[model samples]
Target: MLEGKPICGGVRVARDEPIRYVCADCGHMTTTRTGRCPSCGAWGTLESEASSAPSKRSVAARVVSAVDVRPPRRLSTGIGELDRVLGGGLVPGGVVLIGGQPGIGKSTLLLQAAGRVAGTGASVLYISGEESEAQVALRAARLGVASDRLLLCCGTDLEGALQNLWDVSFVVLDSVQAMRAEGEAGWPGTPNQVRAVAQRVVDAARAGDVPAVLVGHITKDGRLAGPMLLEHMVDAVLTFSGEGYSSYRMLRAVKNRYGSTDELGVFEMREDGLIPVEDKSGLYWNRSDAAVSGVAMTIALEGTTPLAAEIQTLAGPTVFPYPRRTARGIELNRFQLLTAVIEKRCGLPCSGHDLYMNVAGGLSIQDPSADLAACAALASALRDVPLPGGSCWLGEVGLAGEVRPVTRLGVRLREAARLGFSRAVVSSRERNERVEGLEIVAVSHLNQALAAGLSRKEA
Candidate 1:
């Protein structure tokens, strides 16, 4: 027997051949050994693995007709919000990888979902490599998730735990990082081990025609804590995000083979469990009748859902030579850019004032359409004037102060109208369509938008 470790226990490399190295953090492959991984910039993560030769045996490739194919049926996770983010629901034999920070409700969400799936009279196997049965049981009890069909297994042997997949309708592995394969070298969470565990789970789920959800841990930098191959091997990748201080959580699909990645799911964490939030717009808007300075509203779209977002700003004389610019829920650079645009284009003296901006309800706004609203809020704060009541701002503000049209204008206007906003200020270039009971005030430049939004008389 040759004194070498074979990748597949069959082939071996020559003694003189150069060894290949794989980055444990990102699965970047290179023949040359290096101290740091070039891909992920992680130090000392590259490990040498023996390369194998291709076998001479050939198998015929099987081809299928596209016309004969049918779409896979989706299984509901018993949560409408989750199902929405999942593109309707889970497809049979599909593997979903959900990653999040600790205490961000990844496990809690999965546990509740598992209980729901089990409630439909389908056997659900909950495999926990990190938590013991007692701990999971305690959580289940607290969540009021008592389903006779929900099974629990607490161990690190991923192969052994997956053996019950044949008898279960749905399966969940509480963290893939902690699970180890029987034959894989290195401990669990090592690049090799993570790859092996994920591959085995994918194979088992496909073979058994069962849907499986895997929990993944994130690095300090917030990326998934494993080889990048782990994310590629999964059918879908979902990210759970929320601020620790806030009870609201957002679930988004970064990659989905069966559905759209644009969908978003909103949840509110409560004592009972994760409850789906229906009126997502209401969560971000105060709907206050008392018009306050520095407050502006915008109809922002999250996926296909329209949200009513409120932008608040505060501008005061700064003692420091460089006025401070602080922002929450929106990027600081964006805030600064808007302030500069306001000063240069709108003739608002924002440089001398220490600017502070925030999106109400702790909801982050990524929509460029909110640019007009943000600018309005900043100007209103600088002038200590409140925006006209029952008005909404919608349009992207250009560096030249041009009010650019945004996508899905109809959807946004309808949402604004539904929220009881009497008028919306938008780009004049946009093709205006009448939304019942909602007035549309179109402006081609930021100056017109500001005038319409801040003017005491309704436009």
Candidate 2:
């Protein structure tokens, strides 16, 4: 009777009014009383839903004789690095959401995993909402995915895609933005549509006891492009991030209900596909034929794996009136604080110089254990002296110039030793800390660390 569609049986619901009922079978919303859903046409299926009110129905409880305490088996993605980042492997009925910048290889990685899983005699469903089947096929051919068990479904309608999901062990939704749910009122990629599509996919996967991977786009500021609850609905959130110009990519779990968030997976892009970098330290440490000035090595812990990275710095006279400070792969504020500590405590004046610092190999270092190495690099560049060969630094610098002890010192030192480092400069405050292969050079302050790290003349 009104210009707008009827909410129930010829009942006009205002646009601003709250919805009072939802079709339990079809998930259609309505504000008026109706025996049949207007969208799905189901009789007596309209359920009364309240936004803020609790249910008045009676509650029933059941007693269980015993509980199944067996651990859920994980399906390996066939890539050791990916499997490691995913807490060993994918669990059945679990949903994983991966977000990354465009051209960051999110789709490539998922396709690779699907191919690998399908190789093990498991049926894999790859739902492509963004790319055509031909495009995915061409890419899969290039990646050498010739598995007959890997099924591809290219469409935007979630209901249409669900029809092909039967008898599939693994499912991959290549992008949630391009998918639309049936009977949803919003356009594709909107919050409502995304929520609906995700809910339906997750419910279907859970009912079939299958694991699903959902690809999501990132906003301009590097956040998942969807409702915040989208993350909560999934079992894990993995972020694939890297520099656009750089070939190195990192896969880290932001949230994992089944595994530890501290784990990280490293990969390098190639002509075939992404290859996991097993020698992580070799990727970051620049193996120079000879020792170079303004360079220092430090061991950093990314989750449980230890990584050795080279820190390089350049300190020169500033042409402009104000001195300039720049940092790459390191925090600017951390650099500023380290410079101040060097000026105040180490007796090295960086105030009038333009200081530039970088972590070698595009490896972003967030751990404070590299602080001593950064300070050492800055000091070496200022003095134009090369640090000793076969040595690694591990300590944090304090405001008072003290070399603070770092966590997992033994693990870091062991990694450095395995990499053939002869000496490790650590904090003197560490009690009875020593590694078997490397000699520990304990220092109390930044000045002492510089003296131990740099050549004879600079010290």
Candidate 3:
């Protein structure tokens, strides 16, 4: 007989039972051991552990009225860009997991935010398991973040860090992988330990009604270095990304429970710390009046923010049988598709020429609206003719080479006009709304757009 009374659906198992295996990479559990995880296909990731029966408790279920539910108020992180990406600000009891490559300024951004929140007369706790107190202090000093209300703790014991959660209004864990729970099996950074640490942090934040941010690491594939379950357990998942050779950094949300994930935050790493960039277009646009071959401008929208970007391409004769196609800041497949479109639809000789493309200012754009600009740049380079000065392209090219209307035409044109652009090439199907100080050149086909935008003068 069991020593303790069994509750409803709660059963005690015998001491001898089959051991279970759990995948360390994807958090998959199975009674049978396996060499690779069926979920994520990662080999040698399954770890053995004892299996335990789950207790099923029966409790009264209450259905609350939707009218009684009120949205939680947000606490500002004192950084406008960060706040924008976070869907306005951090909510009480919300857990945010932000991941990035090493040396991407995750700690610096959080420390600066903590300092700012502490400056507002609210206590903020910063817990670091990866760095020593002195190291963090030295970096904090370098960032000029000195606040009495900002408390610091350095340790891997998650329970010890949560001890101060109730005393603080905001909390930050430098990294979840570096922290461990009291009774968790395996070492820190293991799948089990990561899950345990995240669960503990989530529970503590919910109980204390404080906003918490967890810094996470990214794998070589640019994915968050943990089980998929870690992302689901958090309220928001943000990615801080930037090129190693560039000072610009972009922060965007992959998941947000409280708000929209369309917002983006731009920052520049400076001597003091990460500074928010107000004029994002200036970073990508060269404001030059000189018309050069192989260069075309476009206004790409990052969320609601419109940025003027320059796309440059080069086309030269190749000696090899198969000409090389190289692209940076844009997908190679997309570039190839556009090259094929230009060659077939516009009658451009791209089959024998080596093509190279890049987005200016080290900004990676996924917006399809820049398709027209890319095609125009490629055409201009191949023809050795410079595109018209003060012109912007806004359209999506189809496989048949037809230019399709893009969303937010007026927004893109207005941004172009603001940057002193005089003309914009757009799809003929789009409504011709007159933007102030901007002329719209609508074309139904890529051929028409190329003919209209490219100047007769050769480079």
Candidate 2 TM-score to native:
0.84
Q: Candidate 1: where are CA atoms >4 Å away?
A: 1-18, 319-321, 457-459
The global C-alpha lDDT for each of the candidates, from Candidate 1 onward, is 0.90, 0.88, 0.91
> For residues 40-148, what per-residue lDDT tens digits would candidate 3 score against the true structure?
8999888888876665886878999999999888999999999999989999999999999999999999999999999999999999999998998888888888788
Query: How many clashes (backbone N, Cα, C below 3 Å) per candidate?
Result: 0, 0, 0
lDDT of 1 by residue, 90-159 (tens): 9999999999999999999999999999888999999999999999999999998878899999999887
Q: What is the lDDT for 377 in model 1?
A: 91
lDDT of 1 at 363: 76
- Model 3 C-alpha RMSD to native: 3.9
lDDT score for residue 312 of model 1? 93
Tens-digit per-residue lDDT, 282-387, candidate 2: 9887688586788999999899999999999998898788899999989999999999999998788887799999998887899999999999889989888988
User: Model 3: which ten-residue window has the lowest total lDDT?
Assistant: 1-10
Candidate 1 lands at a TM-score of: 0.91
My TM-score estimates for the predictions, one after another, are: 0.91, 0.84, 0.91
